[model samples]
Target: MPVSQQRPLTFFGVAFAFLATMLGTTLPTPLYPLYQTQFGFSQLIITVIFAAYAVGVIAALLVTGRWSDQLGRRPILLGGLFAAMISDAVFLQADGLGAMLAGRVLSGLSAGVFTGTATVAVMELAPSYLKRHAALAATAANMGGLGLGPVVAGLCSRYLPDPLWLPYLLHLGLAGLAMLAIWQAPETVTRPERIRLRLQRLSVPTEVRAVFVPAAIAGFAGFSVLGFFTATAPAFMGRIMDVSNLLAIGVVAGLPFFASTVGQLAQERVPLSYRLPLGCVILLLGVVAIGAGIALASLTWFVCGAVVAGIGQGIAFRAGLGEVVAASPLTRRAEVTSSFFVVAYVAISLPVVGIGVTARLIGLQATGEIFAALVALLVLMALVLLRRQRRPVMP
Candidate 1:
């Protein structure tokens, strides 16, 4: 099809594709226990495997994060879908640790490509009148997709024929459809006659530093809450609370993401000055609740904590993204956005590994309590910093 003649892609279409790829990233969440049983791995190994996804994400973000800006959004989106397909294939064929690691890394690569590019694409494609609505759609797609993965996998695991195999197969099919839709979708970036791709170093420019620093820190803390949930919540449920049902675990694990979506939607009403710091305060409460849940051995408290954290994360992450995007020059949007994600992913990856190693030594309950306390402290500090800094004007 000719470039201009191609059917225009709606915001929803782009958001759906984004959702599918993100969904694939977390589809294995509920299946972690099954993998542990089949492969005979320790809790520490499980976290290490999970962190492999983060490694791939950081690698891709550092290298090709700006490619979409130069090459065009359509190609990067398609590439992400293809990477997700490959990741799904690896999971379907996975029989051991190596396969699992390879699959997660591929999934991370897909996510890294999609994260910033898709968000930008959705915003660009939306009708100017609906820009705010488009932003919410993109946020929902990113976080909501993540939230759905575990639920889908958990249900499939509980009621379907093959728990591990079926979830990936379903995602593979969705990914294929997403690819087809995006292939027909219009490209938003103007193509240069000659493309020059280069490895972009990761750095936040001085102009954006004021907004980026606090926003990134808030992102890190918000994702830390998510990291703890996706990586360790299931184990906590099974090992500590004696809740062995995959479906239940999936719902609990998925709650934060769903709540995050709600929080993002609610951000439209919140004043800019209050959004970041208030979010941190909410996050602090959520983490404290999680600690109480762990210390008291109450599933109710844990689930409550997940919901509260999700809300806080959603609000803070959206505000941070908005601030970064608004503050960035048009030409550097992809790179700046990716930098924001780098901080967030680091929060997601490292803390889980810390918890994993610590869990092995001090026991899961104690480790969780300690992790929660530390995260709470981080959030408190972020809140203080955000409160002191001059608020950036929203575009």
Candidate 2:
């Protein structure tokens, strides 16, 4: 169990596999506009479709949250990859909304299985000397990969021959490669274990509550940033800004995620105590920019806001996660992480749907300003709470 003796290659393999899985979940980000055109759906419908994916994620977290820790990381990951492959196939044959929804549902399940399982696998495989780096790797791989997906898809959609088919086809290839990688990677868990399958409710230990509250709040705020881009940014860019280009839409929509990736990279340098509050304040600035973008109807302004806000989200999120993981027992780290994800996904799902409703009633521009302001308020409240906790206690 020496720190130096752990196999770095196997550790990397686990990280890469998880990264691929997360990428697969977001691969469809740019394709939503195409789907909307093909299916003739409205903004509300699109949100519903995106929310369906979140629902699948929550369902998997509740059901299999603890299964991977007990059953072994390889099995859970392989299972997740299998589901992702199925999801790609579903999209490939997608002829209507039903097929697309099914594909999204499967995609969500794949993420649910992979997220917790892969994080544990990476840590289990890491060299003891690199244990702290292992945590950064987990957050970076997950968030960074998710950010990369839409960008990749956007490039392919614009430059490549086939937009829809090519992206999914590329994903299918990546997923296959990941499968091979996983098969060859080392298994972290010992055998002779019981596997239980049933609905499980989300829970947190009292010891973890302090870290959990701030972490979950940060997750909520960060993922809401993601939701704005993934769920609605494309539509806004194309329809409102008059930029109907696929690549532009994808890049603008993907800005926050990529910025977040950068933020996570910076987490090791910034102490956790400062990361949360500072991130919140920076996020507020990004929100302000987004609101201004909507008010001014400027594409450049909106994209700029996404980039700035994305960085704050990334910093806060990684710091929050680090705090929670530090306090969680290794035995149930994956479960705790899954709980964190469940909160994040809720933030991703509901608020974006609300925006969709607003877009329908008020207008896309107005809705954008409204959502930015609301999320800004939420981040402000979280900042106040986190600062209060950081204050000294009276004797």
Candidate 3:
């Protein structure tokens, strides 16, 4: 128990659990084409299936987001891993569209539970010397796991024996291991003997609204870019550009998330006041590049844009989150953090779903270009709002 309670070990252990859960969520990303092919569904159904994940996430955040503050961190973390395990099992046994939808929603629930809980848990568990660096560690695990899922799943499906079954099989094994590892980690929250569970009603304190609003706005726009890459980019590669190799598609599509992970390294050195606005500027450039790529049918431009936008998203994500978390009261930290993610995941779901629908009407290429343009416009708006402030947003 004493060994299990060691700060670094517990910190890393929970972070690994966070990574493992997220990895499962994205495992289906590169494989979506296969599922469409196997299930004989249209592209619209694919996007809807992906959007279902956000619905589940929003629901979980609204319902159980605060439970971690009431219950201990370890149990909530374990619950999320268990949900991921079930999601993997659903995918393993999936036979039709309904099953696929179910799996995605379950995957979203797992992610929703972990995103805020694990972020705070790892930060809380970090030793004093590493406190400032803990946010990078936590956020990197998230983006890193997201980046790895497609590559790992793509590889297993491409080279390994079974395409659909093998990736989930490997993840299931990892989830099991993650559960055991997390069980040994110490709980960061002090638990009450009589714990009462209630739904989390989302609210930002009057004082935090200033920082929270701008941060959420940046997150919403940046995450919309990520949503496009995660949900529609693969289809664009295969259908529009004629890139058919699952490995190539996965590698290309996963580039933004990988870039975001790298961006976190640099954000650690950036000043708190400068991070959000600077990130917004970079994100705008990246989205515009992506728009041009779609208009010109150039994959290189798309990839370039992805890297740029990812870096901006990473910087904004860490900066916004650091400011919000630091400002939140100790009792409500998880709730506010969960609320921030609610906005981020909403960006992930709704805009991409709109793209999916719009693609059916106007076509994928045009829809992607329009989406990029709109995201760039949104970023500009956020920057304008940030510029209007007389006092610096962050202290």
Candidate 4:
């Protein structure tokens, strides 16, 4: 269909596609323990396997993050779906660490393509009056889909016949459906009569740096908390709290994301000047709560901390994204957004890897304390920056 033709349901269809792709990316979170047992790998190996996905994400962000601007949203989204399907296939046949790592890399590629493109596509497809609503829908789809992945996998793994095989198979089926949605959805990008693709370097404009830096920092801190829960919280729950139920583990791991969704929704009402700093303060409190939970080994404290931290992350991420997106010109929006994601993914990968290594050295509990303390410190720094920026100019 031509870009001019519009479908009323197109917005929802694209959002669903976003949800499906993200679901595939995080489907393995609750199943990591099973992979460890089957493949006989250490915690560090587990984190390495997880980090492989982030590596792929970073590569894709640097290479093709802005391609959607030239090629159109539907094609990039379809390509993402295809990559996700391949990742699912790898997981279905995964026999060892290498296979799992490959699957993660492929999944990351799919996510990297989808992240900025899907958000923009959804916003563009919305009726002029509903752009803000579309933004929320897109954000919800991103975080909600990620949050749902573990729940779906955990439920299937706990109750179904084939734990590991079932989740991937189901995700593959979802990917197929998402592909169909993209096929029918209207293209949001305007195509030139003749197209020439060129390598686009990842660069953030100087004009956007002030807003981008603090927002990116807040995103880094928020995503770090998410990374810890998704990558290591399952293991922590099993080893520290003696909670081995797959469903329980998945729910606890997903809490931060769920809370993040709530936080984002809440941010829409807050004044922009106050939102970022306020988010940082909440994030600091959440991190402290998590540390206390770890120190005491209390499930209640941990879960509570997850909820609090998630809310903070959600608020800060939305505020940061809003600032960066607002600061960028339309021509550079996708590149800038992708740059933001690069920072967020690095935060996701490095901190988790650090925890994995530190856990090996200092033990999980102590590692949790250290991670919490460091993240809290980062949030504080972000908070200070936002507050300083907010101060009235003394003429």
Show where candidate 1 strays beyond 4 Å. Answer: 1-10, 127-130, 206-210, 325-335, 390-395
- For candidate 2, the per-residue lDDT at 232 reads 84
lDDT per model vs. reference:
0.87, 0.83, 0.85, 0.88
The residue ranges of model 2 lying beyond 4 angstroms of the native Cα positions read 1-6, 127-132, 193-200, 205-211, 325-337
Better of 1 and 4 by lDDT: 4
Clashes of each: 0, 1, 0, 0
Q: Tens digit of lDDT per residue, candidate 4, span 1-395?
A: 64444554788889999999998888899999998898888899989888998998888777777688789998989999999999999999999988999999999999988887898888888876677698788988999999999999999988998998999999988899899889998776798877776655667999989888889888999999999998998888899888899998888888899999999999878997878888888998899999998899889889999999999999999889988999999999867887898899999899999988999998998999999999988888887777777678989
TM-score of 1: 0.93
The residue-by-residue lDDT of candidate 3 on 1-395, one tens digit each, is: 57534877777878888888888888888898998889997888888899989988888788878799888888888888888899999999999999989999999999888887898888988888889889878977898888888888889878988889999999998899889878887777887888889988677888888778888988999999888888887898888888778887778768889888877678768777888888888888899999988888888988899999999988888788888899899888767887888899999989988997898998998888889889988888778877875365676
Q: Which candidate is the best by lDDT?
A: 4
Given candidate 4, what's the lDDT at residue 390? 69
Q: In candidate 2, what are the lDDT values of residues 1-395, reduced to their tens digit?
A: 55344478778877888888888888888888888888898988888888888988898888887776567788889999999999999989889889888998999999888777787788878887889889778877787778878888889988898787988898899899899888877677775555555555556788888778876876797788888888888887877788877777877876788798788787668765798787888788988988888888898888889998999888888778878888998776766877887889999899989988888999988888888888888888788778777789989
**Residue 76 of candidate 1: its Cα lDDT?**
90
Clashing pairs in 2: 3-128
RMSD of each: 3.2, 2.9, 2.7, 2.1
Structural similarity to truth (TM-score) of each candidate = 0.93, 0.91, 0.93, 0.94
- Name the candidate that leads on TM-score: 4
Model 2 alpha-carbon miss at residue 70, Å: 2.1
